[model samples]
Target: MNLALAAAALAGTPNDSHGESISQGVDSKHILVSQAQDWVAEDRQLQKSTIEVAPSDRRLIIPVCNTAFEFNYPFASSQKTLRAVCPSSGWQIFLGISVHQSDNALRYTGNFKAGHQLTGTDVELASLSSAIAGLAGDLRAIEGFSLASAVRAGDLVMQRQLVTPIEGYRLNRAVAAGEIVESSSIDSILIASATLSAGQTVTLEQLDGARAARDLAAGKVLSSYDIKKRHQVLITQSGIPRGHPVTRANIALQDYYGKLPNDSLQNYRSAEQMQAIRNLAAGTMLRLSDLTPIDIIRKGDNVQLSVRAGALEITVTMLALENARLEQRVLLLNPESGEEIQAIATAVGQARGLSTVAR
Candidate 1:
């Protein structure tokens, strides 16, 4: 049988975790060939070979050696002679080796534009014997990732060729301190900021200290610019009434551009489900200390009331007589009885009160 082919067939045979043969090395020649296969680089594989092992040599026990046994190459680059060395026993055997080029590679099935995200459909397996430098061997690693560079049909997809999508806010133009960054001058850039040739991501903290180091031109990619620390202020989109829940609808984010007092919402999520402590006019810049969380019950607002008595729990609708936050005492008016009672604000528009008959 062909030596390299014999080695491949025997090498693939299932073995235990420690690589002990399930067949107990019953086929000694095959086991010896399989041992030589391990020396080949992952990128290369043995093809065909002529191995000569003496009948007397086959019976000799070789102790495991920590160093690798050298395989001698005697012929052209495609063919070799592998010699297994037993350093402890001082024994050596020469085996004629023949090898063919092998490659685990990826080939593009179709053309893709630069900056395009690579999909599974764009790639397919290449021939195993066709080795290409820098080619990717695993499809799972590259699929769904974007290519760092473009590729043509039949082009090789290599490691480090794909990138993860970047998502964040990018500045469209530069600004001086205390100047409000206009909407037209900034946008969300999904590409990585490090590779960005034109934009810089603006964080809420950056808004506090951020400013153009000097005059910056429009269409300038932000990644290269330096920004001082700053707080991105939330601007009132519309006039916000006192006690009104602050939402995205009524507020917009803005970066400080000039020398101004530091005041703004640091987190975009903070605006969600929050209420204004006082009335804010349209376009008013917001500060972290300016707004409070929404009150659970508000004055003149309709609220659901839960009354607990022993095992009986009753739910009734009532009007709030005063504004209150969670767990705060608030006065609730019974619309039908025209009487007010004390209740604890529990949740938004929800309150808990003691059961009482109308007085």
Candidate 2:
């Protein structure tokens, strides 16, 4: 590549007839001039900006953190996006044409606007300096992840993109120039689960995975409320009467029935069959295909209940005895015989009914 070629290409100034080149002096002065011109061209970075991205893109607005100074009182937020532009270099000084002619790199950087507040936050600041510094760092972080790709959609390009999981992940291990490695490890990740976080710790979440692992009951139909696994069921360690606070999902009544099959209640019709199950407890796992809802019914007995869309004979002990005095369970019995036919246990509702007398 001739050092003078670029000059000749741009300026078709007839080569001095005597072959005396226009670059009679490719000195520091000439290089400096070019450098100045380069700066001039890049002067209005915002104006001269060619969005190196898709023309029509919608950038994802991720809420990095919430700023609240007082407890229970959330800070009022008028969120404004901070934008970052890439200038790549600042004040540059091109010294002596090509260094092949004279080895010298005279590039200097002054002030560059990497980013700006598209919409700015008006935080009640105790200290302006701290806020400003924090904001600068945040701006840089935003800039660091602002990758512009020329994604073409038809004739126009859309420069918008979502912030992917590992978008700004920084790789650690160095591979020699020509190494063909299948994978690379990261030095660390930027963010982790809202519940977990550490500098270099990473959360390897499988997309659409269970928010957290738990027993998946066969008929458990999940809903939006269950989608967020914020409520952690903690069982008591005391090993007394199998009355530990069992971790049963608080499924919606509607969802519970919706999941049950049409013929679920039919399986538990007999008095003897229902009689065998007076010791039902809340948090008890029920599978109507194998479990009965209302156990034990005698002759002339009337089962009291309404069947809804999701009909299931779910046999369950009351969590606490029904209609109690001194928090104790009362017996639902045969008034004539004064014998306990049905028992409503207290606290952790479980069945404690007497055996049916033979006619």
lDDT on C-alpha atoms for all candidate structures: 0.63, 0.25
Clashes per model (N, Cα, C within 3 A): 26, 25
Task: Estimate, for each residue in 48-135, the C-alpha lDDT of model 1 and write its tens digit.
Answer: 3323323233433333344455554444454445566644445456565444444667889988865566678888877765556666
Q: Once model 2 is optimally superposed onto the true structure by TM-score, how far is the C-alpha of residue 159 displaced, in angstroms?
A: 7.3
In model 1, the worst 10-residue window by lDDT is 5-14
Deviation of model 1 at 280, angstroms: 30
Candidate 2 residue-wise lDDT at 198? 33
- Cα deviation at 10, candidate 1, in Å, is 26
Residue 100 alpha-carbon offset, candidate 1, angstroms: 2.3
Give the TM-scores of the predictions, in the order they appear.
Answer: 0.33, 0.18
Per-residue lDDT of model 2, residues 48-72, tens digit only: 2221211111221111112211111
